[model samples]
Target: MRWTAFLCRLAVGGIFVYACLDKIQHPQAFAVDIHNYRLVPWALLHPWAHYLPVLEATAGLALVLGVARRGAALVLGGLTVVFIVAIAMALLRGLDISCGCFDTDGGHGVGLDLLLRDLVLLLACLPPLLVRDSGPALEQLWRGRP
Candidate 1:
């Protein structure tokens, strides 16, 4: 069970880290992708696009490093839920938008495919959320004063 939690952290963390790299490098494209969603107001598009990647990267790094497992899991888990909602709504409304999971110039858009993928990732978050003592978290192993 603890091993499961560790695996969950790695899977989800790796995803967020992977997802943010492109967006962080290509803020303008990400801004356009956010605009395509038409959910956030225009004024917020640039800022949200710019800062979200930072948040995603930070929390993801924390999870992977096992420095703050519970807090990072909560944040990344909540983010997964948000992504699921956005993807589902985009599919339901038939809006043509980048899913924004990985890249801004997307081959992957919000649809049944991406929605299902996000749902599976969300499920992965559960073990870390529920299991307090995840196996061999690096922070625990370090035994250094945090």
Candidate 2:
């Protein structure tokens, strides 16, 4: 169980960190991607693009480092839910746009596949959230636990 939680943390955290890299480097392009979704308001596009990546990176780091793993899982899980909703809305509305997931430029189009992927990522967040003790976490090391 401990190993499961640890592995789940690594998987979700690594994905989030990787996903944010392109966005962090290309905020303007990311803003355009978010605009393509049409879910965010015009006024909030820049801010969302700028800050969301940072948030993802922070949470991902915390999860990977085993510091505040549960909180990080919760945050990443919530973000996954939001992504799923955005993708579902895009499909239902018949909008053809890039997912803006891992990359802001030429990303794959929104589709059921992306939605399912996010669902799986959301599921991956569960163990860290539910498990009381994360295996070999930085938190334990910091507290001098063997």
In the predicted model 2, the residue pairs found to clash are none
- Candidate 1 residues lying further than 4 Å off, grouped into runs, are 141-146
Residue range 104-138, candidate 2, lDDT tens digits = 87879989989889989999999999998777788
Model number with the top TM-score: 2
The alpha-carbon root-mean-square deviation between model 1 and the true structure, to one decimal in Å, is 2.1
* Clash-forming residue pairs, model 1: none
Name the regions of candidate 2 deviating beyond 4 angstroms: 144-146
Most accurate candidate by lDDT: 2
Report the C-alpha displacement of residue 5, candidate 2, in angstroms.
1.0
Question: Model 1 reaches what TM-score against the true structure?
Answer: 0.92
TM-score, cand. 2 vs. native? 0.96
